[model samples]
Target: MHPQQQLALALLAYAAQRGLAVDRLARQSGLDTAALLSPTHGPLSAKQWHDLWLNAAQLARDPTFGLHFGEAATPAALGVVGQLVQSSRTVGEALTHGAALLPLLTDQVWLDLAHSPQSVWLRFRQLPTELAASATVVDHLVDFVLAFVLHELDGLLLERLQPRTVRFPPGARQLPEHLRVLRAATLAAGPPGEYSVELAGACWSMPLLTADYELQAALLQKITQWQAARPAVEPLRDKIAGYLLANAYLGIPSLEELAANFSTSARSLQRKLQAEGTNYQEVADAVRKSLALHYLKMGAYPIKEISYLMGYNELSAFSRAFKRWTGHSPAHYQPASASRSLPG
Candidate 1:
């Protein structure tokens, strides 16, 4: 299925809760009502999902609109992870297990951990198709991951839920109370998909969350087994993402260039992409889209500067292409809002 279809379905659910009908929103946004509603039913010449959401956000005057679907419903996969975390005996154990289980839920998302003398860093990667859903997916995934771990370990909520920016709507009381319950130290919403916590570096000083290494091992084995049972198809998608990341700002290359980089001919490259259910242009655009978001978060440069930095030749073309990727104009992305929400 087209990843946009999944996003549209999530948006449709969110709209229902806001008392805003999708059909009306579609009309207001100049979206093809049928296409927006049922993109998978037929081939959509235009990317209606992103366009409509952008329009709705513009009309609603909320930059964060369509970025996050409200607490109207908990997505099933996230809920499953939440439940699994709650069952774990300790915070550390829960985190280890949850990290293990991520692949089973969505290959589109991954979590990794690294520690140095100073800090333990948790990083996340979203698949190209998962990029648009980053706000919702990352927010929920981080919160739920912590909730399960902290809940198991401390029997309390997280001390803080800090994001790069608080993208919630005005009078968003849901956030403050949620933070209080979690004991969040600072709940700023700077960027999505990342967070930090204060921790002592001594892993040996910490006790294991559970004494049952055997049981924990068994559960982890089951999760890995489940993941292995699925076809290893998403790795192909990750390869596409990896290629884009390597080439995102190098300027758009022809199929020949891409093929040469892969040590293959253009035909072989085309066949490989086709087998993975994508094309060269689509992958390039996806890379551009992800970079656009990254640049938006950077917030120091003007939109035009960002455009040039992203490899576009002219301001107008960059604006049009950005709109094509994200549905919002560069000027309206509100870097200040993002800045206020980031951690030091």
Candidate 2:
């Protein structure tokens, strides 16, 4: 199943275990229980998914409520990597291996890494998917990847963990309950949209999760060897992303402009993109979606400024596009209470 469905199931299971009514939670999150249960249709919208996760967290009083969704089952693609992780020498090595193995599971996502002398920022990248429900899939993947690795590392279940910041905003009257679960001091005011966890490199040794050493090492090595021969699609996607990064939010380029930049005719470009399982519009949308999050995280630019930069002639146009991208309005996307850091 896609990560989003897996995530929704995970949240449903957690709520059931906690003795909370799933229907009630669904209602609170503005979800239709029947629709959520429909497997034939695509995933829920980004906002709908976030609202459900947020509602579940509030009801369970656990920030990690969303994280636990992956533990219930191992995805087919993640099996080998899961073994490698289930078996690594240390938490750091395991995570490093897992990060490298991420592409094997899905090239649609990328992990963002910010390494410093004192701290290491391990951020999950949510690549733009053409599917409307792709945002939820991205969200669930972030939770799943982190929770799965942490669980194997600690060799124990972590009921108390929470993201330092939730990707979506916290619901009203929910912070106290969430605080009870996370038990971590939150930053006062920070970036508007990006969700992050700031941890010291030393914290890697803190034993968030535990596992067997030899088996994990063998698994890691196997994954390493397997990845060596495997085709890496991210490089190609990044090439496309690199092209868009230069003109982020300016406006969508014409088919000719895009094809020229890539050094090919429009027909050839279309064919190549189709072969790559994406197209011009998909790539352009992905670029803008990514830029939206990156700029939003900076918190310096106003919503209108970001909208314009994103190539929206008016804020409303940007808002509509953003909603389609993130399932939340630009104004409503940024968390109000969290402390934001300035871009360096």
Per-candidate TM-scores read 0.30, 0.36
Top TM-score: which candidate number? 2
In angstroms, the error of model 1 at 320 is: 59
Clashes of each: 16, 18
lDDT of 1: 0.47
lDDT of 2 at 177: 26
Q: Clash number for model 1?
A: 16
Candidate 2 least-lDDT 10 residues: 169-178
- Across 1-344, the per-residue lDDT of candidate 1 in tens digits comes to 33334434445544533435667776664556556456464322233543555555544444334222322122221345545654565445556666776664444457666555554444555545633543443444344444433333432121222322222222222354345324555554323434544333443124443322232233344334434554534444455455445323224445664553343568887887888888887887776676666556656445664565456778888888878777877766646655432221
Alpha-carbon RMSD, candidate 2? 22.7
TM-score of model number 1 = 0.30
